[model samples]
Target: MSLDPDFAILLRASADRLFFLLEKFASARVLVIGDLTLDEFLTGQVERISREAPVLILRHETTKQVPGGGANAIYNFAQLGAKVLAVGLLGKDEQGKALRSLLEAAGINTDGVFVDSSRPTVTKTRISGHSRQSVTQQIVRLDRKSDDLPDLDLQVQISQYIKEQINSVDAVVCSDYGDGTLTQPVISAALSASRTIVDAQKHLERYRRGTLFTPNLPEAEFAVGYAITDEPTLTQAGQDLLALTQAQHILITRGEQGMSMFNREGSAFHIPAFNRTKVFDVTGAGDTVVAALTLGLTVGASAWEAAVLGNLAASIVVRRFGTTTTTPEEMRVALQRLLEEG
Candidate 1:
């Protein structure tokens, strides 16, 4: 597809703005709230089929673990030089402790992370073969978390911490993974505190005042209560979500088709995904996108500019094999290439 002439100009403008924004990221502070998870990857070789069943027999291999979901988003922000504070519920377990250690090692402030003794830490394990193909998957995904609002005592503590820190931060990012942590009350408290960016795991109408909504196609459809089969429908859906969420900006991630952004002003822009040979895994791409968007806005980039930066950041991560965070340097290179091509 040919680039829109106007979009070309916009892209050029965004590229210029990115240079300044990149510097701002070093000094920006962000608050992250939502589900926290442990992503475990077991890498091995599938030697042959099992005689007992039509299944591949995999040999034992190396194990790798990373903080994921909302925690991962916070990690991405911190890695990009942002002072990050993360608030989420974790079970009192070994995995939870490990996740906490990982965050601290990465320089994320975990003062807001609370322990839910009623639940176990959520963990997703993927077994991949030598060829980097996922051979099996298992989730010890624990949601023993209560849907009930956070403990009154804990909520009071969290609210106090947020009040003290909110004004000092540039942005707040809600990385909901359909986990019970991000309740209506939690969102309300966040909105009352700072400029909020949300990456919803599901359609949440109550979160309308969010500064930005980043939902993939399916999530977008769910948010608007319709199937997005074409551009018109997609545009309408974006508008519906923007209105419902009271958000000024909506970004619908279209996978292979790239992404489209709709602003409160009734203007929409689409940017195609960077051409790539293959997609290995798309685990943390959304987190990276939200991180980039929030960071972009903190540095004074307009909504459109932030969305474009998000697209560029996601393009690089999708081609990787597992949950990974994109660095600012990587984003800078991608933006430079896009501009040089113009």
Candidate 2:
């Protein structure tokens, strides 16, 4: 239920080293390839009930756009001082324009982003309403995307870009959201690079052996075809996931219970949740984990140590709404506080 006391001490004592590793992010290049989405949050006030329908009218207030999916992971990586190269598809539309501007403002390299005329930039809009004294809550959501895959030319361009960029980056992160960007060719090209990590919604087996797979508890259960209600079952689930995916390492993120790790050789480690504080929002927490964990591995941290850093990163991002990111300085402070409190 808690982190080992000695392990906590070690984590604390290595604070400087951890920060040093974070600094290395500036030099280590990571390629993020997959679904690039624009997340729009519209916050308004509940005005009155509609005359013709049961819905309540909302007084328009403000709208904000941020990165989502693979874009969010790239944002997290950039926030942590990593040199991130983003490779994905975006439509030649306003949403795509805004998303690219946001990424560029965050210092993420977007030259690899393919602009396909056939698809609209994937956009998820969340409408939140609040009374004068009540907290805002999401009332509805709308998604805009293209159902078809990228045209042949666009697909070929994406694959060629991956091949060209693969040899240069320190690590490759496949942030698949079942979007067309992460096609089989893209995955194959990315896996050809060194130290590839995949965070997918489903079909874990697509990524071949030696890849690192990060799937949350429910995702793992779905992939492994069972319930993971206890430690033993969780252990077995991790084992099953590794064998099913043919991955060298598997990390199962368990929200409050923390994260569980497994490798091909049968070694497993469970990292307890870093914070005892209330979770404000869990949107994009998985992206934070994938970002921090892959960054850790890029810097040569052990599987368990990387998971610990990821656990800490997730604890920070969940305290905010919409897609958010954790910074290196924030992580250092949180880890230090976790040590002192422990």
Candidate 3:
């Protein structure tokens, strides 16, 4: 797709302001409340094709683990220089322990992370096989989670934790992956707090009267119950979300097409995708957007500017493989490069 000429200029003009906001990230405190997860990757060499089956035999290699879901959003905020507090549910298993360790290692406060013995940790393990001459790619993924609702006592504990920290942070992020932590009580407490940004997979409408809603194209379509194929349809989807959820603003993320933002008062605009040349993997790109947008609001950015920062952050993460994060320095460099391009 060809670059939008006016969009490039707008980004160039925002460079100075974006830099200032990034510098303010260090002083911003954000509380992320939702489902926590551990993402595991197992790497091996593709030795040969199986004689009896179509599967390829592999040589065992290494296993790596990182934070995912709400944990990943916290990672993104921390890497961008924000002081982060995370609240979520963790199982009393090894995966939960590893996830807590990863969060603590990043200097994030996990006081709000609760442990429940009845459920298994939400863990996604991906196995990658490769030959000597090429980089490994994920062949398959295995997920471990609890199908049952968490104990009522556990949900109450999570709700109380959010109420305690919501007042202390500059902003709150509800990163729901349809896990049990984001129940009605928790969502109510979150919306009561100031400057709440939500990125939820389920119960999108249940969250009402919030600062912003960041949903990817498909997520928005699901909430609105229709296909958003073009500009007019996309605009209607955004408006419908705003009316349904009553959020102050709605930002629909459209992968390579970039994003569109609509406020409750009928103001709307679109941002073209940035750094489109080298998108290797889109894993956790939405997390990057949520992190950047939340931090932008925390630092007093307008919704439009926050969405722009989100676009830059998403652009950076998509160029990387696997689940990862982007730093403030990286964002500055990206903005500067775009400015130079013009």
Q: Each prediction's Cα lDDT score?
A: 0.79, 0.87, 0.89
Per-residue alpha-carbon lDDT of candidate 2 for residues 41-67, written as tens digits (9 for 90 to 100): 998999899999999899899999999
Worst window of 10 by summed lDDT in candidate 1: 138-147
lDDT tens string, model 3, 1-342?
Answer: 335778777776777898999899899999898689899999999999999999989898999999998899989999999999999889999999999999999999999999999998899999999999998888999999987888888778888888888889999899999867788888888888878899997568888887889999989989999999998999899889998999999999999888999998999999888766677789999999999988898898998899999998998899888899999999898878777775
Is candidate 1 or 3 superior in TM-score? 3
Best by lDDT: 3
Cα displacement (Å) at residue 308, model 3: 0.8
Candidate 3: which stretches are off by over 4 Å?
Answer: 1-3, 48-56, 133-135
Return the clash pairs for model 2, or none: none
List the candidates' TM-scores in order.
0.88, 0.95, 0.95
By lDDT: ranked, best first: 3, 2, 1
- In angstroms, the error of model 1 at 164 is 2.9
Write candidate 1's Cα lDDT for 124-186 as tens digits: 767666536654554223333344555666656666666677887888888888767776667
Candidate 2 Cα outliers beyond 4 Å, as residue runs: 1-6, 13-16
**What is residue 281's positional error in candidate 2, in angstroms?**
1.5
Clashing pairs in 1: 208-245, 208-246
